[model samples]
Structures are given as structure tokens and as C-alpha cells.
Target: MSALVIQTMQPDFVESFHQALDAVARERRYLSMLEAPPLERLRDFVADLKHGNNPQFVAFDGARVVGWCDIRRHDREIHAHRGVLGMGIIDGYRGAGLGKRLIETTLAASWEIGLHRVELDAHADNTRAIRLYESVGFLREGVARDAVRIDGRFVDVIHMAILRG
Candidate 1:
């Protein structure tokens, strides 16, 4: 693999990004999405992020996207200081500190855009992710019992957040 490059999302990355996201979502173990949305929809979503100045970062090895992290700010006036984060790393990239790099990059960008808080939900079974969130200063807020059904199996969701000064 070439040197891993992490950068803000750009138009040229659309297709590879979509493929990477779809691969992770299809794993059915971590993210809420059992499968990725259509490519056009993903394109629109990335456009919205760019237009809104929301933070979205993609990690790549040469031309292939390996992982991504994004934080979308709330639209309501009262919630404007907050953003929700979402991220995923493809199979081969999972435990090598890539998630840390992607998330911290996105979080720094989020703070720059005047967001004071960032939130995320993780599958209760994803302890590795939970620990990563904690390392980045996110505190566990609460858990929703059986909040989702994946593959006919109920899963609890842990809500967590981090506040910036």
C-alpha cells in the first residue's frame, strides 16, 4: 500500500468513497445502515456537506478510499452548535489507528466551524469503537435498549458526546 493520505472529501473521490462506505455498511456489524444509499444520494449528501461547511474527511491509500469520517451540523437555530458524527473503516483497515486519525481530523474541522458539541451512536457490542470515542473525550450519555434490529437480532445503542471549549 502507498502512504495513507487523509484529506477533506472532494468531487473526484465520490465513487470510491461510495464503494468504501457501502462495503462497511454491508458488513452489518457496526453502522446503523445495513447498506449504503445509492451513489447519487451519496453524491448529494457530500455536496450538502461541502456547501454547509460540515466536516467530512476521507482516508485513502493511493486512489482507493480506505475509510471516512464526517460530522454534520444541526440546522435548527437552537441546535446549531451541535453536530452528529458518522464514520467507518473498511475490513482490512480496522484496527491500525486509522479510525483515530479520521475522527480526530473531522473533529478538529468541526470545532473550526463553530460547533461546540459532537455526538454519535455506536453499537453496544462495538467496544473498540466505544474506547476510541472515549479516548477522544466523548462521554457516554445513555443507552437505548434494543434500539435496532439487524438481521432479526435486537441491538442496543450507546449514545455518546464530546463537548469542545
Candidate 2:
């Protein structure tokens, strides 16, 4: 219950960050990963993210990463004005208002990086996450039926986006 600090991800923190992500992924709740990518591959990926224009933020409790969020911009010129968002928080930190901070920080960073449209998809069953996104101005655009398979069953995915005014 110490102060939580939010900052841009750095190369040196990739391993711990990956471990944190894997822990959340294994919970079988939000994300669909059974295990995260190997350390070497994830290290390179994080390095690449550092070089890209996309903005990523990590919330830390001292040295441990409790949450992470990022906006990955489309590469093509026609789609470059938009970005896709992804985020996850460790199990113990779910309802403490950390998720809101992460999303808000990412949205602000998205605008700062010149992105006008930001989109995200959440499992339709994930009401808490969908509510969080909506509270921050994201609107449901459509639903991709059976878009995710979790624990052997399909789940609808809700596509949501927020356009800069």
C-alpha cells in the first residue's frame, strides 16, 4: 500500500515487467495467455517498443510492476492517426482505481503523440473492464461475435473507441 508511481517503460525493466504480465495472464480472467513469451523474445519486443512512437506506461509499487498499458499505432499512413490499446493489472490490484489511472495516462499520452482515434476490444463478459473504458469516453462501436476463446468456450468481444474532439 505504498505510493504507486506511473512512468514510461524502459529497456532495463523488461524482464520484471514480463513476469508481472505472465502472472496476470495466468489468472485466466482477463488475458488469454497461459504463459508469456520467453524472456529473450520479450526483451527484444520491449526494446522495439521503446524505439517506436507508441506510448507505454507502467505503474510500479516501488520496484514491482503492478499494471501496464500501451497504445500501438498503425503503421500505414491511412491508419496512422489511430492506435490500439492493451493493458493488464496484477490480480491483487484490480479494484483500487489503478486501472483508471493507467487508461487515463495512456489516453493523454495518445493525444500527446498525435493520435486522434484510439480503439480497444474487451471480452463482452468483462463488464468491469468495459465500464472502465466507457467511463473514460470510449464508446462501443460493435461486437465481434465469438472473437475470443477462453477456457474452451467462445466469448463475444466488444470493440470500443474514443475520438479526440
Candidate 3:
């Protein structure tokens, strides 16, 4: 495995990013709550990469993009010190520590931007993700009951948060 290079997302990488996301979405059933957005919507999504103090990062193996993570600031004033995170890695790249690196990089960037806490939600059934979050000091704050419907069944989501000192 080549060294994973973490960098800010660029416009030219949108298509590759979308392809990687689609592959992961189809395989892991981790993000089953949402459908893959259209290319145009992805363009808009990428356009908001740095909106309102939000930052997005992409991981690459040589010239191929393997994963991405985004940290978006919370909207309310009371929660202004915190942010929400979303992440995904392509199918073939899982279990290679790339996800951890992606998350660590994102958290480091978030802390640098003055965010004191980062929160994320993962499906309760996603034990791999849960363990990874726990390994990085994210604690289970609560459970959102039936928060998402996947494959005609309601699935609970585990809400987790990591605070930076």
C-alpha cells in the first residue's frame, strides 16, 4: 500500500470521488439511509467544501482517490464550538488503516480551525465503524431510534462525539 495522501478536495476530482462513494455505498450498506446524489448535486456539494468554516478532505493512493471526509460546523450558536463529520472509503481500501488516517486528518484539521468537538452518526449495526470511532476516543453519546430506513426496515443510529482539549 502506498502512503495515503490527505488533501483538500478539488473540482477535477469530483467524478472520481463520486465513483468511490457509490462503490462504498453499494457494498457496505453503511450509508444506506441516503441515495447517491446526482453528478450535478455532487458538483454543488463539492462547491460547498469550505463553506462556513466547513472543510473537506480527500485521501489518495498515488493518483487514485480512495476516500473522503467532511467536517461541517454546527448551525446553532450554542453548538458553535462543535461540528459534524461524514466519511467513506472505497470498498477495496477498507481495513487498511486508511479510514483511521482519514478520520485523524479530519479531526486534526477541525481542531486547527478552533472546533472543540466533532460529532458523527453511524448505523448501530456498523460495528467496524463503531470500533474505529471508539479507538479514536469517540464515545457513544446516545442512540437515535429508527433514525433511518434501509431496505424497508428502520435502523437505529448511534450518535458519537469526540472532544478535543
Best by TM-score: 1
> Compared with the true structure, what per-residue lDDT tens digits does model 3 show for residues 1-165?
688898888888888888877777776478853556888898888887566767788998887889999998887999889999999987778898988988998899899989999999999988999999999999999999999886678879999999997
Instruction: Please rank every candidate by lDDT, starting with the best.
Output: 1, 2, 3
lDDT of 1 at 36: 88
List the candidate numbers ranked by TM-score, top first: 1, 2, 3
Quote the RMSD, in angstroms, for model 2. 1.1
Q: State each candidate's clash count.
A: 0, 0, 0
Instruction: State the displacement of the C-alpha of residue 82, model 1, in Å, after optimal TM-score superposition.
Output: 0.2
Colliding residue pairs in candidate 2: none
Candidate 1: tens digits of C-alpha lDDT, residues 1-165: 678899999989999999999999998999888888999999999999999999999999989999999999999999999999999999988889999999999999999989999999999999999999999899999999999899899999999999997
Model 1 residue pairs with clashes: none
**TM-score for each model:** 0.98, 0.95, 0.91
